[model samples]
Target: MVGCDDQMERLLEDLTQYSGSSRERKFIRIIGMRGIGKTTLAKKVYNKADIRSHFDFRAWAIASSQHNVKKILISLLRSPKGDTFYIEDEADLADMVQKSLKGKRYLIVLDDIWSTKAWDDMRLCFSSENNGSRILLTTYNSEVACSVGTENLSL
Candidate 1:
């Protein structure tokens, strides 16, 4: 993180900012070329002590080129005991995630997201309740970053 102090600060501010009126779930997109510290920055922000304390639940999933919605959901919904809950249906898994996270402040990090379809699929697992939840996405594609309609941190 030699030259990433500024970007790290920006991400921390974005992650912690709040508005009294609208506590809707927000997306913080990190866009840059491959191997340009996108994932590294996201990891640093996600692992901060204050960040861990701020959210009721935090999950991390890697969405590489061959992203699978079910797999991603499993990663998000895994228990602290390292037990992987098995569910054959994707919708059922997604429902479990939503039900567990409903009305709670959560942080979901989708690292290495390669396509808009991946975001579309994973976003469904989260409820858009005004609980100040957030999704931190790291992608190498500008198009995928812009599709979320949020401010992107270009690394």
Candidate 2:
């Protein structure tokens, strides 16, 4: 973040800003080439003390080259006692995730997301409540970045 302090600050400000009655959840995408600091920057913002305190719940998931929506949903729905439901059904898992974060202001980091389809599958698990909840995504593909979010930081 040495050379990217300004970028980090901008992202932080965006995440903390108020969205006026936009019931739709907000997304902030971090985009850059491979080996660049896209994921690093996203992690920095995601782990910030103030940022952690700002949200009611937070979860980080990696959307690998072989992305699995069920696996991603499970990561989002994890509890202190671990898989409270322990079911194999994707729809049920997604419902659990939605139910858990329904009224809470959550911060979800989908790190290294590779495709729009991956986002499409997982987006259903989140609610469109106007509670200032946010999703921060990292990707190497500019098209994917643009398709998922209007607010983005290009590393």
lDDT of 1 by residue, 2-119 (tens): 9889999989988888866778889999999999999989988999999999999898989899999889888888843366887999999899989989879999899999999998
Candidate 1: C-alpha lDDT = 0.88
What is residue 78's positional error in candidate 2, in angstroms? 2.2
**Model 2 alpha-carbon drift over 4 Å, by segment:** 19-24, 79-85
- Clash count, one per candidate: 0, 0
Global lDDT scores for all candidate models: 0.88, 0.84
Q: Give the number of the best model, judged by lDDT.
A: 1
Best by TM-score: 1
TM-scores for the candidates: 0.95, 0.91
lDDT of 2 by residue, 1-155 (tens): 68999999999987878766464568889888888998888888888999989988888888878899888888777732365457899988888888889899888999988988898888878887888889999999877887886788888
Write down the RMSD of all candidates, one decimal each.
Answer: 1.3, 2.0
Sliding window of 10 residues with minimal summed lDDT for model 1: 77-86
